[model samples]
Target: MELADRVESLTPSTTLAITSKAKALKEDGHDVIGLGAGEPDFNTPEYILDAAKNAMDQGLTKYTPSGGLPELKDAIIDKFKRDQSLVFNRNEIIVTIGAKHALFTLFQVLLNRGDEVIVPVPYWVSYPEQIKLAEGQPVYVKGSEDNNFKITPEQLEESITDQTKAIIINSPSNPTGVLYTKDELEALGEIAIKHNLWIVSDEIYEKLIYGNDNHQSIAEISEELKNHTIIINGVSKSHSMTGWRIGYAAGNETIIKAMTNLASHSTSNPTSISQHAAIAAYTNSEEEIERMKEAFEERLNKLYDWMMEIPNLSCVKPQGAFYLFPNVSKIVNQSPFDSVDEWVKQLLEEEKVAIVPGSGFGSEDNVRLSYATSLDQLEEAAKRIKKFVEKYSV
Candidate 1:
């Protein structure tokens, strides 16, 4: 039987692909250091886990309001008010299975066939695929590496057409870890407003920022911008709650209602116990979160320095998040390999170090290395990578 066209065209996620290969090799007793994982190495905090246990003990395992538990929505509302100073009523929010699901549902409800969504290049692996799944066309706007992999307002302005319905903005981006400054956001928001386009702001990594960089939502810049933007966020990265699968979208009531209605026939609601745990995640003290951020910062600093010492490699210093995207085209050109994907493959086979090739992320010259693992492992991975580069690059 032939698969559906939508399913047929979808490329498997390269992040998951590389991670799975590393796991398989490890199972065979190969000493594989997988730097491809995008999750925090730390376990979910004790307080959040305690809340889940309490929730189960209270028999809070039944279905909830299709949108979310009221209290959970209130908690999310409070979080917005606290963090970004943005206000939203409960009806304007819809709890989703994850931030990914929130984006998928938004596109599903917002796009008809052939509608175009402006996607900045070097985006997360899922964005283009998700857009295609919703029968929407993804129009790519390249974010040049010299600009810290961020697209300029002129570029965004030039990319829009009447068919352009929305644009996605992921700060502290998945592969690059680049944060958009407030000024940059305002410029982009101005263009978005001019074009009357919806802004899908993915801030899932907001809490993982490093150094002095602060995260500012475009929606928070103005009431006008807020009216047109939907913020996608969750506790997955912030609270190390990836397994909980609880995320939310906050914005206009009409869109939220549509997402909720679609979800009613689909996921129904996020798992009840996980909802309770997410409440704890937002309400409780963030000391544990701060500690995790500190660890990631240290790892990033050391790994970045080590990576730079390797000949013919270059990278922009990331301001937030836990991943480093390094351009390896120079070394690849000098080496026996013809492409970054081949170099990545042979690096894994010879040195047992796994990293995701940037071809999957729409940039051919770079590869993404996650610093979400142990310092020792990152150090070792750096060594192995340097050794491989030295061996091959004449």
Candidate 2:
């Protein structure tokens, strides 16, 4: 049987591959520590779950509008007002199965064949693949460890061309967990306005920030850029509702309506019950989110300190999100192993610890270790990694 050419060309998500491998090991009685998955270890908050139950009891099982339930869209509109001080009409919002799906729909709607998207290096594993699947070219702008894995406005300006259609800004970025500061975001926003490029801001980790600085969305900085910026956010990270499959994108009416039409013919709105759950997540402010943030912060600090003791392993303190992208080239390149892939493979096989190699995220000299696991697991995983590195020292 033949598959579609696009499906045939796409690679599976490396993060999911690592998670599946770890699960398979555990099923076979091996003790595996998985630090590859991106979701928080915390369970979906009780309030959100209760809302879903209430929805089911009230017969919310049937499908609603293609974009989203009106109530949920209103909740999202209200959320932007309360959280980011960014106002948008319900027509400007499109709710999808997840933030990932929202992004895919946006790409599919906006990109014609060969349209180039400026993707910063060390991006989320799925960004480039999703672009490729949509027949869009992902033009990567290299970011260095020296810059904390962020791209400068000058770098962004230099990458644009007539064919450049959009640029993805994933502040509080995945894998790296670096949050872009306000000034930095403004600079990039100015460039986007100058180039008339769409800005797809993935702010799913907005509430997961760990420092004194609050997470800022680009649209919040300027009224002119607000219409050009597509803000993608969800309750997945903030309320630990990953499985709820609810996310929304806010932007101009035309772009959002196009995405809504795409979703209508595709997934047809998000799950009815999940939308209800998301409504609760937005309306209610629980201390649980803060509690989870504290836990993640504690784990981040502990992992940073532990990694500091390990020779040749270095990581910048992540300001948000739950993963740490540490440069392990000192060990990977020096080792007899030929590549980062080989190093990661040997570590998983020998030490029963799973981490995603940076090659999957557009960097070959580092690996992403998710600290979303428990404190005990992080401690054990760090110990195993240290021992493995010591064994291979040059």
Which of the numbered candidates is closest to the native, going by highest TM-score? 1
> In model 2, what is the error at residue 297, expressed in angstroms?
0.6
Per-residue C-alpha lDDT of model 2 across residues 1-394, encoded as one tens digit per residue: 9999888988777778888888999999999999997899889989988999999999989988999989998989888999889889999998889899999999999999999999999899899989998999999998888999999998999999999999999989997999888899999999999999999999999988886868888899889888789999888988998998888899989989999888888887688999999999888886899999999999999998987888888888899999999999888767889988899989999999999999889999889999988889999999999999989887
- Each model's lDDT comes to 0.94, 0.91
Q: For candidate 1, lDDT tens digit of each residue in 139-255?
A: 999999999999999999999999999999999898899989889999999999999999999999999888888888999999999999999999999999999999999999999
Residue 124 lDDT, candidate 1, scale 0-100: 94
Stretch of 10 with least lDDT, candidate 2: 9-18
- Model 1 ranges with Cα > 4 A deviation: none
lDDT, residue 333, candidate 1: 97
Candidate 1 clashing pairs, residues 3+ apart or interchain? none
After superposition, which runs of candidate 2 have C-alpha atoms over 4 Å from their true positions? none
